[model samples]
Target: MSGSLTAIALDAVLEEHGLTLQQLAALCAVDHDWVSRHIEEGLLTPSQHGGEWRFSSATLLRVRRIANIERQFEALPELAALVADMQEEIDDLRRRLRRAGLE
Candidate 1:
């Protein structure tokens, strides 16, 4: 989110498939240092594989979602809460629609 579309792509690849930090940077065509900084900043969290960082597809997707929201809102905390509420509302609506056989 703080970065660019490249960051979103990197996040997507990581989310879709488990990847190491190095692998993720490579996929994004960026430096490992950049990725490390982002991770340290709490923008990313990679799983550990034998003390090595690994990423899951879900995490990447989450990162992408976070980034997208941040880009739109410019403030992560507010956007994150808004997104959560929106998702809950959507889920509730879907449930009601299903009960009505209109889903």
Candidate 2:
């Protein structure tokens, strides 16, 4: 009984129907205003229909990354965005490396 704890990983299947602003806020553990601020800062993108906003799984992932950086490092929104940008670039490189059999 001396092994490290193991956690189950779920392959979350985001609803193809898309998520609303409130749903996104709940997932990100932030308030509506926080999400709005990110959107205003040009960090998060949303699609509007009939004056309501909707987000996709990719946006959810990006918001989670931005929120983590902001909370963990106390980074400003812009700084967190910069970090997210670099992280995305690293992710792209890793994907390329894997494609090239270098990873």
Best by lDDT: 2
lDDT of each: 0.65, 0.83
TM-score, candidate 1, is 0.45
Model 2 pairs in collision: none
Alpha-carbon deviation at 102 in model 1, angstroms? 8.2
Number of the top TM-score candidate:
2
Candidate 1, residues 6-99: lDDT per residue as tens digits? Answer: 7788657655557877666665555788567667866666877788888775544445555556567776544554574576578779999999
lDDT of 2 by residue, 1-103 (tens): 2232221111133434467899999998999999999999898889875688988777887899999999999999999988988898999899999999999
Clash pairs, model 1 backbone: 15-57, 16-57
Q: Which stretches of candidate 2 lie over 4 Å from their true place?
A: 1-15
Q: What TM-score against the true fold does each predicted structure earn?
A: 0.45, 0.79
